[model samples]
Target: MSGSEALDQGPLRVLSFGCRLNTSESVAMRDLARRGGHAEALLVNTCAVTAEAERQARKAIRRAARDNPGTPILVTGCAAQLRPAEWAALPGVSRVIGNADKLTPEAWNAAAPPAPVSDVMAARQAAAHLVTEFAGRARAFLQVQQGCDHRCTFCVIPFGRGPSRSVPLGAVVEQARAAVAAGYREVVLTGVDIASFGPDLPGRPSLGQAVRRLLALVPELPRLRLSSLDPAAIDEELWRLLAEEPRLMPHLHLSLQHGDDLMLKRMKRRHSRAGALAAAARARTLRPGIALGADLIAGFPTETEAHFAAMLDFVTEAGLHFLHVFPYSERPGTPAARMPQLPVPLRRERAARLRAAGTAAAEHFYQTRLEQARQGQKETVLMEAPDRGHTEHFAPLRLVRGEARHGAVLQARVLGADARGLLAEVA
Candidate 1:
């Protein structure tokens, strides 16, 4: 699970966990729940990325039930999608909605809901739900794609998310335009496997095509950002956008789960270490100041110390500015779980080492930029909070004090660095 939060009103509260896609979908679900007059209920949007994630969701459900004894608790999202009955059987859960039903308003307000889930693989298209607002986000996320076509050995997401599908280009443009019209300075294109977008579309358009079209069609949008991307899937058009589209933010978070070639192959990943390096290099060459980030897994099944060492080196080689290090946790049914397993403690230890390296890399990047800021290099930041924002390169910044407005872009001469982030005052 990526994160969790609670939103409470008179009748409806939502507890959401997982990715930005989930966050966007939760906003849609929130609207549906509010409008359906189920606002008094508690909805838990769960994640099933790891066994720990499911455990956390279950724990959260129990706690929510204990805390709000009178409130009805509804469960949904990836964890629920995979095991609807399992969640339904939980003590506090009054009802369980599958991934397919989570966004459907009728399901939330049904007189009596049917069997909560259907054959997910049989569902072909992504539901095109345009969320008008993000309750507590600086930018609006537009989900242009959903589901995954590839089945990696270590992942259960494909089963939970269903087959790869794209929201039609027109719908994407309209959503982006609406977000810009609604006064959002930034729009992030999000999805289950965003880089794998458009294969199921009419023209077999690439992710690049959708992004190019979105920018062209919604010229008023000040900034466009992307979610996690597969290294092998970035096309020529995406490269062109990286080079030329100033509005396209200069940061790419890659879905490079590991660096060892054997581990990557065993994991059924398409890109190799060399390919990942090449992709990062190409992105950097195209967008000179672009920041690169990636998701890295430590201690995958049968991963040796040498293998992990290679991964640690790859982080520096790729010049990664951000890192999401996941400790390998065995999900019961995945192919990796059936393979030779690493001890849980060992996996966590490796993860900590990787995270420390990632932290050092991030700090180095911040310190370098802090020096540049001290040298009078002006940075423009979009204020997400009254005192917090991030740079275009996706570096976090904390305002020391200033006339700040949420969602407004500000030019600031970063004064110094701190544990919170870059300490800055308006230029």
Candidate 2:
């Protein structure tokens, strides 16, 4: 979960939750609110990825109401999209807007209808918002697409978001160019399912084609990165770019979900255990030592000890450098929720085990990088702060002997490793 404020003293305050998409949308909402003259509004953009996420959003809303008396709190995003009346009924909530209307200018108008949440499934086309500035970050997230078409049994995102819709190629390039103009060193192409990016477009371009074009058009853009991707849906053009494009960052975060084939089937995921390994192997082969990250779920319905063990082993086999582990949260109305459920304690335990494995793998990878740095290898670091930043591989780097301006990209050499991350010196 990520949170941000429009301005320290600005009249409108925005609290965003969930994925990068939500963060990008929050920034847009803040801009809309300011433009619409909603000076006393407090916007809470919520998420429904898991039950805990919704709980946290509710908690934040209550806290906001308690802390700022009489503020008109407008709730939006996935949680509100799914349950408008329920969220609108909450104390201090002035209105509940759906995902469909949240980004539109009309939704922010003071004279708009109350609780305006339309059926998300009815949405087909997704328009690109020219969001160049990301409130307080070095990297700008450019949403190239919207929603998800696949219905993974353990997921509720599709219902919260809408069908997979691509923001036209021209719009994507325009946004990337704008981000570069705004002095953003890095721009991450984010979406609900980016791998499924282009069939809806006129020419039916792939994600890789869009990327290649963006890099070409916006040659000054230093680095380009992608948000979480679906491993099973990677196209040939994307693979080619991975092997050739220097501007395209090497770090890839895959939405693997689960490692066991049986569990994947139960979860309605497209990739198998072997398919995931192949994806990782292909990535490393194309971009040697490229950092690999995965989103894995532990204790899915009917997952046995053997299944769990296989998943643990898969982590080591795939050489995953980062992991986003989640304990299975049974969402109501999902197919998995209707299946045989795993004990909540067991699910949490398995999640911990997966996280530990990921930690060990990441430490080992960092140590390897540290060794290379000792050998006098240099890395391009994008400083997110005066003394901290990340490498092309997305390794957290902390400068111990030098300082650089935020958003400055420069070469640096790693000096050592700490519990936090890599310690480095500007070269």
Candidate 3:
């Protein structure tokens, strides 16, 4: 059958919700369905990071059913893990699978599922599996691990996703090669804890080794990036690999929930603000001019004035380029939700303060870049202008008064900042 005819035979309309890891899994699953010639109607890959996440997942499934009224619904992901009963009972949901075995076809067809999906794992929590062998896309991700071993008091992930898991390095490399061959320009190594990849295997190759092996396998790819990693997961070797690999994107999105030590402890996080700073420092030293992004939870239970002040101070001093601020939300079955809850008024106040701070912090970062460019520091930019590219710094420069080839990094002379990006002249 022709490829188009094959797709028509059994079309699985895939949808996804949740974190990057889940999104990656959905893409992998969709590819499998397409290749296998079996289609699903609105195969909803739902997410449930927070309670709102669960609500949204339901909304997504219902919307899918509304859009494709006659299609079947497949519900899965974190939302499925912690709330299988709710999902399975949805109007059009045909099957609901938890993190345990949702990625595989057989596991997806399991007759029975857990209600809350609290406590259970299909394979060894660390069993290395790659489900995207025949997947095609402009870019693809390899889910190297699943579940979190860390039972942070504020998190329901442990109860839902089980323990830390890792995929085998060989399977990961092979899948990456296949994806690259399928015309994917980039391959992102992703997971619930990709930093924990290779642990399921006896050899326990470091995250760096797994990435380097994949790069070696697909040396022709234009880009290779990583999903977020726990700040505590890196080491000297990882830093070294990052420094040397030009193909690796110059971005390190660290998980820094709060800047105060007390708040971090309250959240049951493994790393301290100091620890996060130290890692950022090391990464900066290894790769100068790298963009460092971070996650910040503005308000948490029991956070005090002193704690918030400390956090604000740390953020200003950290020289972080960008921040993703989230106000604390209580998720069911997590310890933090039941802890002495912060007043809604207080949470709103802190969120406002943090939002203002984020603006100032970002402005300072942008102004700093302007100053550096003024100092005659020219950087190579990669042109992303479909017809153009920008520098390594990602300063969007116009093709401007000259013919520039697509995807070539050329020295750009910064004109000045505008509502657009770094307006520049091709040097």
* Top model number, lDDT: 2
Q: Candidate 1, after superposition: displacement of residue 373 in Å?
A: 2.4
Worst 10 residues of 3 by lDDT: 1-10
Over 4 Å off, model 2? 1-9, 130-132
Q: Summarize candidate 1's per-residue lDDT along 66-154 as a digit string, tens digits.
A: 88787888788888888888898887777777776667778777456545577677877776666545566788888888889898899
Which residue runs of candidate 3 sit more than 4 Å off their true CA positions? 1-12, 33-40, 64-68, 107-122, 125-138, 183-185, 216-218, 370-427
Candidate 3's residue-wise lDDT over 1-427, tens digit each? Answer: 0001011224676656556666567765565445444455555666655555667767767776777777777666666777678788888776666676655555543233423443445446544444332222234666777777786666676656777767777777777777667655566777776676666677878888877777887788777777778888875567888899988887777777888988888788889888988888888887887777677876688888899898888877676766666677787878888888888778778878887787666555556566887898775665444334544533345645454554345677665654345556676
Clashing pairs in 1: 11-39, 11-40, 12-39, 12-40
Q: TM-scores of all models?
A: 0.97, 0.97, 0.81
Ranking by TM-score: 2, 1, 3
Per-residue lDDT, model 1, residue 79, is 83
lDDT of each: 0.85, 0.88, 0.67
Angstrom error at residue 339, model 3: 0.7
